[model samples]
Target chain A: MTLNLEPLWLTLKLASLTTFVLLVIGTPIAWWLSQTRSRMKQVVATLVALPLVLPPTVLGFYLLLLLGPAGPIGKLTEALGLGTLPFTFPGLVVGSVIYSLPFLVQPAHNAFEAIGSRPLEVAATLRASPLDRFFSVALPLALPGLLSGGILAFAHTVGEFGVILMIGGNIPGETKVLSIAIYDHVESLEWTQAHWLAGGMVLFAFLVVLSMNLLGQRMRQIGQD
Target chain B: MIELDVAFRLDRGNFTLDVAFTAPGLGITGLFGRSGCGKTSILRCVAGLERAAGHCRLDGETWQDDAKGIFLKTHRRPIGYVFQEASLFAHLSVRDNLKYGMRRVPASEHQIAFDEVVDLLGIRQHLERAPSGLSGGERQRVSIARALLTSPRLLLMDEPLSALDHASKQDILPYLERLHDTLRIPVLYVSHAPDEVARLADRIVLMRDGQVQAIGSATEILSRLDLPLAQDTEASALIEGRVQSHDDNYDLTRVAIPGGTLTVGRLDQATESRIRLRIHARDVSIAIRKPETSSILNVLPARIVEMQEIDRSHLLVKLCTAGEPHPPLLARITRYSRDRLKLEPGQEVFAQVKAVALMD
Candidate 1:
């Protein structure tokens, strides 16, 4: 019920870090989805977007078991001297990354789809290796998609309460992100504290969306030529 | 010597592309065919853009062979392909588009100089601009220059000017002419337009339905009356000549054909330039004697080599000229004109050229 800024800052920090990590992993997946034709591509595509459509409650329930002391991931980490993953900030990051995955992937898929095969072909003839082509031509052209995906992932992760509560267990500084903090205020009938935290989140989300729209317009203009 | 015994099979619906050809070394060998005739597929196969069953050997180098397990990747093949569109990188400037190819080739072995290509294509002014800003003709010029900079053993161009309007095609043609003259590397030019083949190709490979229908000098196959395309309006004898002189004042350039000299609009080109002239079959009329009074400047006394009915109404007559030793000039006259003149096989006649289109 008390006004505490730590949970909000931790949530923001977690969302930012998770978004950065997801962009690295999501970029290649998006590019492959745009280019690959193999039978495995279908399976990979389904798996990447699976976390988006699956019920978050059910996924969180399963994650609770998977990261528990007796679970395989927990035991593996404990044996490796890292201890358990549950009730931790890193655990919330892992949960948020899985929950907000489709946000990162879909925008990038659309971006990669918009680029023509011409620049890549020109690159090949010019003696650019495939890696060079990806870095020099595909990555630069697909930047807008990446930017939008990263923003969506970060905003969605910041607002996530269900998965974080189920696995992270509302541990104060370690796991109580802003959304969990607002929910705690509501549970205790602390209207004033909830209003301030919720209002800040609303303002942050608006700015992100507005800036994202501008970024998309700039990217679309660059893509047109 | 550049040798190609390449054959590839491609299936598209009911249409199957089964093409094979062997090209002589040097200059340009045109892959001539109609739409959907697998001309582009053949070029793609040569460039390793498409995989085919057949093997290709160029100057004893293996580009593809299913049995030998040698199929170079598209990027690994030392080839330059100019697609129907310029296909230039829209994001890169013209200079970068050119650099795409040049940078790939090692500096020690690169035969094409950067400045030379820029000058050759007349793209120096446009180098800083992106491909989107360039005109269709300008884009194509850059495409040609990009391909040239690759230092390819074989260059493949698939209908590079098909997207352009007539004015653009005209503007792009002279650059191709210059490229054909300066580059000793073999080029495979794919087009359905007979005029393009006549203008630039030293040798023509006529393809019909995924098969090699005819292969010889551009003049020989073009003059044949039996082929469906020979009945076309542009169908004529392709006469090879050396630029004897160009008169600026009169606005005419004289070219010495086998039987006699022909002149057309003056060309600003080097003297002794090899040029091809398309003498329309409909333009030539048969005469038993040299006419004393006539407007046509090109009239050569010749013997009829052969005659065949191209269709119900058109008759194709072949005439032997003095300078052209290999191929004969074909004159397509109406059957009505043929019966009236009593023009028969092996008959001596005076051939009058109505018009001649000189090609660089």
Candidate 2:
């Protein structure tokens, strides 16, 4: 049987979209977690990290309920003339973003925390307004951690299986990502196809982990210098 | 004028800082105190970095007024602050760090040019380099230059030299002296080093235990016998003088103080230029009569103003060389000498100087 690449293309698209969206939304959350002294900081941090420890199926089940037609978010979307999100590409994107959030946020949070408060205060004394300081000083200093976070988020999204299965289901072009396609091949006893996909995933995982280690070493060298 | 009347209390009541003083708007005003005496707290309050309950007015502009319920944030206040550490941005080059504040300031309010500050702090060669490549002294110079380029109305320095090594501190002091000589911005300098304050401060506000101990000219505060500074072993007296003439043959310069002139080691200053002399208490000796032939150079008639027992063995004697209004000279002599001369307040004697340090 000829191996179709539609599932691989779909998986790459979902992972890229999820990584982009997570970086945009996770940055401010990480910054707030690093800088705030409010009582709710721990609560917010725990909520962001919930996807890290919860079983993927459990998380996926809750996400399904929340995005289904009868749920609150589903109802709001319907009221706004947008259809409910379940077994759709958008639903898969949402699930992947939540599942991969901690991968992005933790590194970014640590990076922002490592900067301390002195540079920001110095910027303030130099008459840099709040937004100017954030963009000019804080962002540049935290770029390494953010890049690592984005990479981790993308890698983690690509490997996710249970959450995608629960929320996205098996739509060939829309939600049949690589992990689901590999599972389908194994269920039908298509050993050759499964081996090809599984071997590619192993190589991808190794490359991602190796690059993260290299990036971490580079970050440490920059810190020492 | 810079006016600060602030009261700050930390949580758990472990520390409280209450101080009120006004300093001239022209020269450096040193906040001299020991560590934990709240000098840095006062500077932070003036910069709007630390919130305190009081009012701060800088050159007629109100920075904070609690009674009026107005508190200006730090970025809104036109003040430059040099922290104890050289906190330059790690990601920006020296040029970009200097321009960080200069770019934010409007052109109409730009009083200090970028090139002028770069040359002032002597950081021209390092402009293209990153902060990490600089020595401690070079980094601090860039930090100062960065603050200056903002053209701030007030400059606040919180022990800017405290973090440097001895060699770095020496390297940076001349640059600081040049800044003082060339710039017109008022500075509030916080330092625990007495000699640093004595060399740089025109006026001083002494703090002890979170209270204002005294506020006066540096000369008065340094020489006051009752204050803690005079009782310390490093106590010295400051005297302003005009250069009279240089003795090329002896390699000596003659400086005319209030009532008498002193022949000191050769100086590079021109005739008629003002200079400051720092005469340590230990270097001064008292004599009942002037020695006719002696190797010592400076000897001037003075009357004993007051005497305080420094310890069981030493006595710190305050003397007036030019009478009232002129700063007094401190002589740390053995109690044996005081007894031998029968020294008493208002009695005439001679102060034989052993050394004089030139402070610019």
Candidate 3:
């Protein structure tokens, strides 16, 4: 049988969209977590890291409730003419973003913290305003961490299965991502198709991990020089 | 004048810093103190890096005044600070690091040209290299050049050379001296090294236990017997003099101090050009009468001003030239010599200096 290939394409699309959205929103949150001296820092950090420890189904279940027709957010969206989000492509994007948030935030926060206060102070004495220093000094110094965070977030989103099943129910082009499609094939005893998809996933995971290690080494070498 | 009246307490440790002093706005004013004496904290306050409550006025501009509710942030203050470490941006090339501040400053406020500072700091050759590849001295020189390119009105240096090795410090000191001799900006240099202060500062603000002990001209402050400097083993006296003559035959230069001439090692300076001399107290010997012939070249008649017992074995003798107005000199002599020579506050004697260091 000819492979449909629709699930693979949809998986890539969802991971890409999720990674992009997470980076845009995660950066400031990570920066705040790194620099803040407030008592609320730990609470905020724990919330961001909840997906790493809690089962993906738990997060997906809560998200489904929040985005379903009877939920507060769903009702508000309906009133604004956007309708409810559950079982839609946008709903899948939202679930993936939350599932992979800690993957993006932890590295970026660590990178920012490793910079210490000296460079910023030096920049200030040199007449660089706070915004200027943040862009010129802090951003460049933290680029390696951000890049790694983005890659991890993308890979983790690609591998996610339970969250999408719960909030983005298996709708053909909208929500039938690679992992769910593999499960469907196996349940129907379509062993050849299942083998092809599972083998592709293993290769993809290996490549992602290998690239991350190589990139990390390259960054470390540049830092040393 | 640069007026600083600041008081603050640190939370990490039970340290309270309270100091007030006014220094001339034209030269390097050394903040001399021991480690943990809050010298760096005072510099931070002046730079607006620390949130200390007080008034800091540079010339006529008020940078901070708690009572008036006016506090300029560090970036708003026209100041350059060189930290103990070079603190160059690791990601930027040396050239970019030097340009970082210059680009932020408005064109009209750019009094210090980029090339001028690079040349002044002798970092023209390493501009394209990354900070991580540079030696400690090179990094510090780049940092100094970066600060200068901002065209700051006041420069704050917090133990800038303390992190360097001895050889690196030696390599960087001449550049500092050049900066002092050429630059017009007022500088506040904080350092625990007495030699660095003696070499660079025109005025000295001595600090002890987070308090301002004294503020005076370097010559007056370094020689004061009442201060802790005179009691240390490295105690020395600073004397300002003019070049009188060069003895080409012996490769020696005769400098005319307040009361007498001192024949020191040959100097490159022209006749009548001013110079500074550093005579260590340990290198000075007292004689009841002037020797007719001796290897020591500097022997001038002086009267004992006061004496303090540094220990049971040693005495720090404060003396002034017998006939003319001169900065007092300190001599650390054995108590046995003081007894043998019957040295007293008003007694006349000769001070034989074994070694005299010529400082510019």
The best candidate in terms of lDDT:
2
Candidate 2's error at B117, in angstroms?
1.3
Model 3's DockQ score? 0.84
Residues A1-225 of candidate 3: C-alpha lDDT, one tens digit per residue = 989899999999999999999989998899899889999999999999999998989999999899899899999989999888999999899889889999999999998998899989999998888888888888899999999999999999999999999998889999999999999999999999999999999999999999899989988887666
Interface RMSD of each: 1.7, 0.7, 1.1
Query: Which residue pairs come into collision in candidate 3?
Result: none
Give the C-alpha lDDT of model 2. 0.91
Task: Sort by DockQ, best first.
Answer: 2, 3, 1
Report the poorest 10 consecutive residues by lDDT, candidate 2 chain A: A126-135
Model 1 ranges with Cα > 4 A deviation? A1-3, B11-13, B244-253, B265-274, B308-313, B322-326
Ten contiguous residues with the weakest lDDT in model 1 chain B: B321-330
Candidate 2's residue-wise lDDT over B277-355, tens digit each?
A: 9999999999998988888889988989999999999999999996345668999999998888899999988999999
lDDT of the candidates, in the order given: 0.84, 0.91, 0.89
Please list the residue runs of candidate 2 whose C-alpha ends up more than 4 Å from where it truly belongs after superposition. Answer: B1-12
Across A158-199, the per-residue lDDT of candidate 2 in tens digits comes to 999999999999999999999999999999999899999999
Candidate 1: TM-score of chain A is: 0.94
